[model samples]
Target: MKSGHSGWVLAIARTLDAYGLSHEDIFRQVGMDPEMLRDANSRYWQEMISRLWCTAVKETGDPNFGLKVARQIRPSSFHVVGHAMSCSATLGAAIHRFARYAKLISSSAMIELTESDDQLKLVLAFDTGDMPVLPETMDTVIAGLVCFNNWIAGENVPPLEVRFRRPHPADAEEYLRLLQCPVLFEQDEDSILYSQTDMHRPVLSADEQLASTLDNMAVTQLGQLSERFSRRVRDCLLQQLEQESEVSRKATAELMHMTERTLLRRLKDEGTTFQEVLDNLREELAYQYLQRPDCTVQSVSFMLGFSDASTFSRAFKRWTGRRPSLAQHNGTAEHA
Candidate 1:
């Protein structure tokens, strides 16, 4: 149910413009803010985007609007993910890189790369069951992958088969024509199967060092919009916790390449202090761990940097106004 970036709205606007329709008007029709286009960091509820896609289809009277939308994709539209893809050593490298950082493009969806004896399948799907991308949205995603890879590899890297969850439209001809390969519909999943030969094809623009560098930079930039300063500190703490080390503000600040004062100031601007964010994350994570039947209170305590199981039990009661055992009981009941 995570929100996607503002870039999608702007891309939709450009697509609508081709049909003499106003993208802003369409956005407003869906009760979304057209002003969101101004900030790449701005996001819209996933449901609004579902509505926007439906509205855009009706307004444009184009069954293949999704394909048209795919055509409008520009390299800059994908941000650092695009650059990293372009610099990958081979088409396989590019596709893998794209999958690795696909969340930077849209958190609602994910790209899975699977290998077969003679083929490689790239499956694009909604990672979360609750917020599935609309059928038309999948259309853009499938075609968009083909279009992106073609451009990045400096050739038309058509797939052996393209599968869609939606049924065939009256005008799938355009889709077939644009894809330069077979376009399938009413399939079990949304995917593109590339031949192994195509998978190994060299990316015309490959640069190993530069691609690695851009990926590093992109990781730092992606997902920053939602949590801002708090996310950075949370990430630092998560690393320390994973390493079974104590979390401290000085260590977190140093890991972020910032002074403690500067980190504290930034967190304050986000309406939280570092300790607050850390505890909030810890509490949320604690609840998640406790809700799992296999996790023990003592283990959860250790993960949260508590001195003992009793200390964690008291903190959990304070955070949720109930004992950890009570929460676990409720969770088990809900599942039952």
Candidate 2:
């Protein structure tokens, strides 16, 4: 499942409280664990997070709910990536760094930077698979990017124009008031266009050594995150293999609160696939089961989700270049 840092959840909770809304009630209503807020390392599932945003918008009935929430965001909300951005030499460098480490915030969404002769555009896009992204969610993210940019710059670094994919709101006064720029709706993409001159301006908190250290940490964290995600998929598959005769990608994706396409994509990003993970896991289990004196090949076949002993033997041979019976007799067989 794609997840975001819990800091986002806390920021939203704080915003809801400021609006006299009960964040705990909203979290429960959306099937989210409110206790996740207490853990700094906890991640909120993408689907549950979208529900939280929708619920917050519906309950508050504020057209600028997302903007208000963005205003409440702090550097700590982004974890180390935010601090790294803060120490960037220039606005352009900061934005580039943000785009590079965007996955640290949320894997379901991406931020891209494009440049023209005199303007820079920060484009935002979400890949939630089959889930529909709410306008409020987009608003919070885009607005938050701009707010963070301004914060790091230590001055109001207004964008040249702000564009949204959503239709024009009934009242756009709040957007203009908060964005302080020409806001356009129904645009091809949700983006913030800034002048190149402004982007080249040096950041007030620029620290080369600190930025380098933070960047290295972010890279290491990203690697660890990928490993953790792969482990999560393996764990999910292990559980399903115990319960079902045949486990489909769709079923596993549903269990993970993501779409099959997303699951496949995430696995691909980790240099594997569902089938590969399943096969490898079964191979590992086959060896363990064979090592047990009480377990037979037929029983092990069934336990590993194979339909028959012959099929299991063929798969076992392919994995270890030896028959299951031989592997069992030999105590262990080296994998091919």
Top TM-score hit: 2
Tens-place lDDT digits, model 1, residues 134-211: 677888877877898999878788889998889888878788887889888898988988898888899888899999
Q: How many residue pairs clash in all the candidates, one count each? A: 0, 0
Q: State the lDDT of candidate 2 residue by residue for 1-336, as single tens digits.
A: 577888877889999999998888777655466887887767766766876887799999987888888988888778888999999999999998888888888878678888988988889998886667888888888889888999899888889999999889999988887788999999999998999999888999999799999999999988887777677887898898888635779888999999999999998986778887788678767866776788888889889988888898888777655688775745554322
Candidate 2 clash pair list: none
For model 1, what is the error of residue 35's alpha carbon versus the real structure, in angstroms, after optimal superposition?
3.6
The lDDT of model 1 is 0.76
Estimate TM-scores for all models: 0.66, 0.71
How big is the positional error of residue 142 in model 2, measured in Å on the Cα after superposition?
1.2
Clash total of candidate 2: 0
What lDDT does candidate 2 reach at residue 282? 81
